[model samples]
Target chain A: MLEGISYTDTKKLTAIIKERFNLDFSNYAMSSFRHRVSVAISKFNLVSADSLIEKLLNDSYMFDLFLKEVSIYTTEMFRDPSAWKYISETVLPKLASQNEKINIWLPECTSGEDIYTIAIILKELGLTQKSNITASFISNSLMTSFSQGYEIKKMELNKSNYLRFNEKNDFSEYYSISNYKAFMNSDLLKNVSIEKFLIAPMINPTMVNLIIYRNKLIFFNSILQFDVLTMLTNSLECGGFLFIGAKENIINPEMRKHYKVISEHERIYKRISKN
Target chain B: MKNKIILIGGSAGSFSVVTQILTELPKNFRIPIVLCLHRLKHVRSGFAEALSLKSSNPVIEPYDKDRIEEGKIYIAPANYHLYIEAHKHFALSTEDSINHSRPSIDVTFVSTASVYKENVIAIILSGANNDGAYGIKRVKDLGGITIVQNPEECQVSTMPVSSIRIMKPDFILSSTEIIKYLIDINNKAFFGK
Candidate 1:
């Protein structure tokens, strides 16, 4: 079955972006990208992607908007509490007990929600001092937001989610309100590093203990998803854990061999071997 | 395309109508049927169970990424938008609501139009909003048979009226005529222009 004729226009539009801009979206699902480009086109009041692409190439501002449209920017803290609870209870404890300093990386930590959530988890578990957390994203637009220090936009929703995750204390203890934006406490940033990364064609700093890559895989097609998984696998040392979104699962039959299931329901898998 | 898949979407005053259809679709029916209804976001596991007791064919909320199977009825779960993959599987997303609906009618209808094209039969019934209007148009454009319940007979008229305005639907019948058409649609598929 083919995407409607306009979607064919969408494919040609993305091809132009990929070739001229050298941005690799070869991995994104066609259906997903078509829907995204359609939305972008609708925003510009353009009937076709052909018109949208012509504008994007000429106007840098349009390009930024295009980038924003393509990437799903969700600034959710502890979006799924059960997955967080599983990580806090089962995965983090083992890493904390192994060594004083645990090297944790969030490859697609869009905005700072993921990293800040982990920081709070470490603080509660008394592993804040012994954790070196690194967060990275492919999108420069989102990276700029992350570099400006963590700001919780949906403070009430985050508060509600945090309360549901663990209700022992007020979730507000983790952040201080400044200029109507919730800024994470300075203490949690002591052992953290944030950077923009190109995880696809290149990768660095192998030997990460755990990689939190939830839900981001849905943005890519199966081929890219498998390729990214393979890259993340090489980036981690033996026995390192890989956590995905609640709905995200290792689907490629051949890709399933490298990792062993930690929790099928949570979509958490552990690297069985470094190779 | 094997036996054609039937997709039904509705919002206000559709629960009883859906239950009636679900109860009538036979156990050995070769085709798979999927239903997307707009309901309260907090509902997780109740609607499917309620429908299952009266349904002749088994009815259950589809798990995210579950493979589609014939002879069963799949309901879009609450709070998340539903999508069908080209690989004939379901993928759920928490993307923001469209037309104030999460399991959005347009979202699923357009995707199904893209994937299944002529192999689908889609029906829009008794919704108070215009969620499924665009979807019905897409299905019609993609060469699938599109049906809208008669607005005069429906408890709510906004949905069918919107779709009917956008599309000269192949059939605009009451619930009884629609049910009878669905029961025989597999063997006597809608092929007329």
Candidate 2:
């Protein structure tokens, strides 16, 4: 049997976590939190949570592991066809008409696949040269991985997913295959750049015409979700477009009022003026 | 009485099993529950809303930095690991998937063990492959409590039986019995223990 840490230890650990991460977990379901910590501790080969915390406090490497343990970074290119379609059909035209520089943010961009895919789509649409585009990612490691354009052979599945999103073009045309790996065209990275930062603050201060922070909010507790939505609402220029995951919605009564649904099923919203 | 939290992990036939478990639990129950269910990347439907209709407690797809509260159930949204930070606030991450699953049960259960310790309870339900077994073992290691739905009773026995063989969970009851045990734990935590 796995020996659990004592309640006293758990309290100390929670305090340490709060001090470090600014996350308050007292309201979390206890059983679930305990199990997740155990898994992380086991991975570190540590015998106890207190010891794990000690190591975490002493070694920055453990912080990375802790970040990895707690964060889920799964993403793909053009993840939701309909949402992208909405961007192409509804949002893009408006940006095109204004002829304004378009700034797009992919807050939780994992591995740069999604940003590259969008760049390709813009290039195909004749928007890449005409419009100024910027994409942001959350993890420095992922940014580095994307900069190299070298990925494991595991991307074959994503190739199929790319085909699903853009059937008219051959997905293979965008990359060179080596062994089992698919290396993205170096040209795609010319205009596209990736930066690492947390999501909630990205929305404040950066005034952008469109933000595609899809599927990244589902992991937050209610307060974080609301906070992010508010920040997103505040950051968007009037009439800016906000895209979210198909399963996620701005359901909080206060948050819902700021944006009007553009496509109900696709979870695309357009920010309307508070006035 | 303090409520005992339950964490369940599964993939493949999780939709049906989740429905069955919700159907079996009484409507008046007050314990908090969390789940990690694997799903396709871009599909969207109100999973929490749908489950809430069947569950006694309110069902919600938690937001980032949302606080965990009793009498509410949180589901890992598609494509993210739902983690509990200190003080019961939730943290959603886009870190790489473990065992090929985002919103991995192992990730959630392991994180839970670190924060909840012996106050926790974990269950491995129906799934294909061995995603939750390591997580269940972690739960056991912490002395938090562990349960697995009987393999024979599950639609896919690989997950439950594999956990049984490896984790040696405290119970291997049917889905209905699993619900009963959860309710019993909730009562004990809140009223007796």
Candidate 3:
């Protein structure tokens, strides 16, 4: 009966984890899965996958940490410049035409560079004041650090990026620097709002026009990824834009039916009709 | 004499850089140092303990609604963005990540610039991405001092190089030199003897 317990037991054990944690290991590439499992094991100090499963069964905090460990929160400002450029040139302008307030969501924001970068773009384009922007993250503590705008050093680098975006005005005009610290102006960040949550709840369905969840799905088990994708698709309004990270793809098959690919290379898609 | 405030931002390779700069400062340094280093959410580590070991002054991780005091180094705790209020006190928010980094340097620097303006000293150090450039420009535009780590000396030069190319800070020095300059500036601004 339990003769091949080591190998078959591990397999059954993994299935139990998938069921209990609501994570589907099948979504991630095999290499990524291995890497994630190794990282999780080391991070949790579990001796084996069976141990991890046992730990998860008992500890909710450990289970939550496990989810965070498996998720990829890495991101950059204008990570794919062309994608941002496309939004600045196309989606933003269309929203401008309507003269209606717009809201944006950048989920799984790791450190907040991407959200602030989007705010800067909106400010440069003169849309920040008009639109109501919001970004959400998985961590409340990270959100607090981002809101403060304190960093060791990198303003000069951001200025270079602003120039690439053709922000012609003196970059210095936006901040005050003393003693190696750069303080950013509140005016530029005013309309660019921020929030924190794991998923978009149904209560706030109509508030967003664009949702940028780039590069985040690659870390999720396929089921979690699909669940998130479905949530994002449902959250968007008709003709809204959904920008995924360069490496991530929407492979639910049903996603293709609802959203049209705007830029294949940039992973930008547009909601075609109401689902 | 008004106490000078300094905010520093970095990521990727900031651990050693921050420790080096803090170690060089005096124990009785009469200023506030705020840090915004991007870190992973959850799993609290000994960042403050490590920084305090290298520096003479006390280093502490700031909590939500913490009061800002002179001569203390307040590190933004993991997973939170650090911001300064108009009253020069600390405030934390659980907003979405900006530029995909929480505890974003830009958010902290930008917010500080709004309230502190010319009174703020902003520095950019070793990092993998350009998170603080726009914030540095904002500080400079408000007539504050701006400094960046010399790209050649940075472990990860992308952040410093990008800031230099874009913002053109008043000074670009190595980590040791930056600490010296900070100490000198603080002495001048505070002691004025």
Candidate 4:
């Protein structure tokens, strides 16, 4: 039946984590988190949630690994290639003309796929010198790895997506292959700063021109989703852009008024001035 | 009886059967039908629209954390794993695909079985893969009603055969018989039979 762990186990584990680490998972959706716990149990060759909890209580490194495992990093470069194309063609040029220095935020930057994607876009638009990006990772360890460069696995799909994103663009020009890894060029990340997402304040007081918090909100419950969306809305400037995953939607009627739809099908919204 | 949900899973050749089934169900059918059919990753829209054409119920591809409503047909969106939460809401995951398919039949069926438990009525239909076999077996283990379309009547029998090999399902009915059974259940529910 694959009854790897029970919901009661999740409650117990989250309570312990809260008490020990002061990290609250009380609002995170239970189904996805529980499934991730099951995956962690098998991946670490632990017997059950009890052993996992023992490891977490005693060893600090295990907690980092646990966080990494639970966090979803299944995105590819230029996922929803059309959305990237739209940003390149329409979003960036308009922002560049209006602002002297465009600020962008990539919250939940798990593997830096979106970071590199947006960096490349900025470079192509000659906005790299005029742009600043704040990339937030789930863990400090992730920040270090993403800084080194993205390791290109599944080249075919990423390459195909890049091609689809812009047929006129050459995919190989963006990065160099060394020792079977595609290291993103250092020039692209010159203005990009990395920080740990959870350790920092959830609401960023610094306003940005664009926030691409895509595909990550599905991991949270509706209440948490609304809370996160509100924070993102606040982080955005009066006319800043916000993009989420194509399959996702802002369900709360109250939150809908904060942003006007730029592309309804693409899930792109532009912030409206608060009345 | 109050919190029952029906889950249907199919892969390769089950679309027409699903359309026919949805067409036959009356508009007043109260139980929510959740469909986890395999679809192309890149094609995001239009599946639910096409399904809604002949459906008596409103067919929708629900957003994450969307509440389950009666008389609506929920289709798992492309490129996401659909899970039924304990509070009767949908949870979408961008986690890596299972059995090489996102919107995987197994993921949806297993999650629904876990949440709904004995109140689930799970049906496995025509497909080329064994994706739904483990999930159907899970439903059976949890005392939920399990049905597999008779393999002989399927466009591709591998899915039904795979399921049958793992567990003894409650019924192996043809398409016509499956519709009849579902409508009969709806009739009984309406009449309090």
Candidate 5:
């Protein structure tokens, strides 16, 4: 639907996607969308956007390719250990006291790394039964892939991060490592659920206590950023927590009014209670 | 240096030279300079602060689409590749790193060369890696003046040497000579002789 060399192309694509699939990508940032389409063009070996549009019109399976190309999926156990340590030592205890049932949301979880990490932490804190996690992905493929679990390929990286984060408990006690791969215990991951959810604007009072949407905002344009962030703030209960990636360094003034800094170094914020 | 934006690419051992150059430049020096340096993914602090502490020109890690302001040194943040638009706004990419590095020197150099064309003043300095080799040639191809740190005078010569092998540079200056060259060009441009 998109034509060459202007915003008109992406606008057309958005209309077509909405009309046929009932999915909305209209709020996606134009620069990132353009870059993803460019990558997809090269990846598919299509000469031009016209050819790709033709393929998509003829066959719907091309939607899968578009989905994969646009979203970034990375999974690592305890990716930023210092932040995890802060969450474990400070954040989890605070949340445990506030509510008997701690509902957590990981919006657009690519490979379920952060969600699983949260589950493991909850288990370590003796709050596994008290926790409920809903991890979202746009595609069924992602949901299935994450639910199936993963062999921890980068064991040393995980171990080093965990060691740096918290040496109180031996990192290996949480999972079974065979040869080089760590097979995380299903018992630890019992409270987590993967769901198909597109990030759209909405309001949900007291629905979730914490939302981890790290590093994902870098993929979208500023307009979509503002939209998604507002959606997140509205969805979060008052006094809930939010964590963004380290590289998402600057916080704009508009977002500043809605949250209070828990840890500027860790990029953690607590949603302001507007009561 | 020549009334154009100065673009510098370095990795590994070039940090000392970069600090020296920035510290030497006067606060009045007005050409906008950008740095594309390879850095660790998890090191989100210290580099910009360290540079700012030493340089006359304030060093900053720019946000996405941050406008180009003259007389300040801009460094690419960790885990993002930086590019400049003709509109003079910084753009960043989080795609999988090229040359095993985010904030890749060559990626930024290529974008800068395209935008600034003949007005680009590019310098490839000391580094242990080959990231800036093709970038120097790209600037040269676009009629932008390219300079390399003389390999004989380098702390780690791999990057400068690789760039030199790719194409003949307009100048191969030592650190002292580089500062001198920059000052000379600044004077020439300002005084119109």
Candidate 6:
């Protein structure tokens, strides 16, 4: 029985997970992954990482639970008010004026917050009719849950953030209250194309005009971050905009040249180069 | 000793202690310092700036995956738990808050102690909660030196007192003594003594 997962055990378990689930967590930041693996072991009443690996190999259902456990879903609608404010005030309007059909990609959509926020903003701006939104998730359960609607538990924080982002509109107008739960208006997601898209090398580039891939890259190691950024860059057309989390950046010198800063504090960048 | 990293953790009533230490340290101090102090989550912009105003060296809130370097002070950013990677880079996480704190002192201390082992120098200062107690205990178990702020000198004795209850720290010093001890270590490194 181990007290916690060691760094060596982390490598062994990640390898097993890759072979079993066809998911590559080897490229994840090791410390956080190790922490999550320990949490999983304790949560399942397992004694060690080795036991966790045994259960993972034998049971497919266990993998699904584990996927949800380790994956981060820490998102609130309009969590960072400034980023949403910048999008509403500047980025969206510019894209609306320039393009006939504005293509936006929210890849590996963990929580439904980003999707709803984008949808609400698009509708408010009267750009919904002309926008194409692609929201991707890695698993079907996640998609099902997202369709259910944003949790009422987070409604307090969500409302506060919305007020900070735009005080003109009522935050409550975007969702309906039933059974003490706030179900987002269905029309908000009517135009969204939901699909399963893994975070890996891209075969078919969607070539989107704006990508709000926030706070996702920090989970990946430098090598994996570079690869994912490359895929996002390819999927994004030149002169298109990219929005990452405030603490994330284009660390690779090669990738850095492709995007120019539009808002330094908000971490919004415009794809400036084709190559 | 030259390769060691200093990790200081505190929550409530720690700002003044930290500022004093930073103000007293020489510009040529050799070891890198990592600080994990609890602060307001939504108000993200000013903590580093406030610390940098009086520090001898630059105070930085590093981006995720930024390389950790010597002689500078690195602070854990708001709303994220900070971890020090084995390769000496910073990793940030949006996982659920531990001990009701995102940049939980325990997370940074444990990660650094695990990575650096005997080379880590861990300190716990004044705080209202017992967040750093388990972390300081982990550091001691991993052969890193552990220190607690003297309870009598603390603005809030709960933090150091909690740490002392669990295990014996190597030292229990007042804020002034803590500064002197660090300066002594810095002098030894400078003179190759």
List candidate 6 stretches off by more than 4 Å.
A1-4, A203-205
How many angstroms is residue A182 displaced in model 6 relative to the true structure, after the best TM-score fit?
Answer: 3.5
Worst 10 residues of 2 chain B by lDDT: B86-95
Please give the TM-score that candidate 6 achieves against the real structure.
Answer: 0.95
Which stretch of 10 consecutive residues in model 6 chain B shows the poorest summed lDDT? B184-193
Q: Candidates 1 and 3: which is better by lDDT?
A: 1
For model 1, how does the per-residue alpha-carbon lDDT over B16-77 read when each residue is reduced to its tens digit?
88988887767656678889899875445578899999888888677555778887888887
Stretches of candidate 1 exceeding 4 Å from the true structure: A1-5, A45-47, A60-62, A176-187, B1-3, B12-20, B39-69, B77-79, B85-94, B126-128, B149-168, B172-178, B187-193
How many Å off is the CA of A145 in candidate 3?
2.9
Residue A183 Cα positional deviation in candidate 2, in Å, after optimal superposition? 2.4
Q: How far does residue B159 in candidate 3 sit from its true spot (Å)?
A: 26
- List DockQ, one per candidate, in order: 0.28, 0.21, 0.01, 0.60, 0.30, 0.60
Model 3 off-target regions past 4 Å?
A1-30, A40-69, A150-160, A167-187, A221-223, B1-193
In the range B1-193, model 5's lDDT, one tens digit per residue, is 3448888988878899999999898877777889988887667789999999989888988876677887778999887877775467776766666677778888788777766888888999988888888887888999998899989888888999899888999999999998888877766666564
State which candidate has the highest TM-score.
Answer: 6
Residue-level lDDT of model 4, residues A223-254, one tens digit each, is 88888887788789998999899878888899
User: Model 1, range A202-232, lDDT digits (tens) per residue?
Assistant: 5565588889987777667677878898888
**TM-score of model 6's chain A, to 2 decimals?**
0.95
What share of the reference contacts survives in each candidate? 0.10, 0.28, 0.00, 0.56, 0.08, 0.69
Candidate 1 local distance difference test against the native? 0.79
The true-structure Cα RMSD of candidate 6 reads 1.9
lDDT of 3 by residue, A99-128 (tens): 578878776676666766677778878887
Per-structure clash totals for the candidates? 0, 55, 84, 0, 1, 0
Task: Compose the digit string of candidate 6's lDDT tens values, residues A86-204.
Answer: 99889999999999999999988877888889999999899998999999887889988877665645788889888888888898888889887778887787679888886566565
What is the alpha-carbon interface RMSD for each candidate?
A: 3.7, 6.6, 19.5, 1.6, 5.3, 2.6
Superposed model 5: Cα runs more than 4 Å off: A1-36, A175-182, A202-206, A249-252, A273-275, B1-4, B85-87, B91-93, B114-118, B184-193
Deviation from native of the Cα of residue A3 in model 1, angstroms: 8.2
Between candidates 2 and 5, the one scoring higher on TM-score is: 5
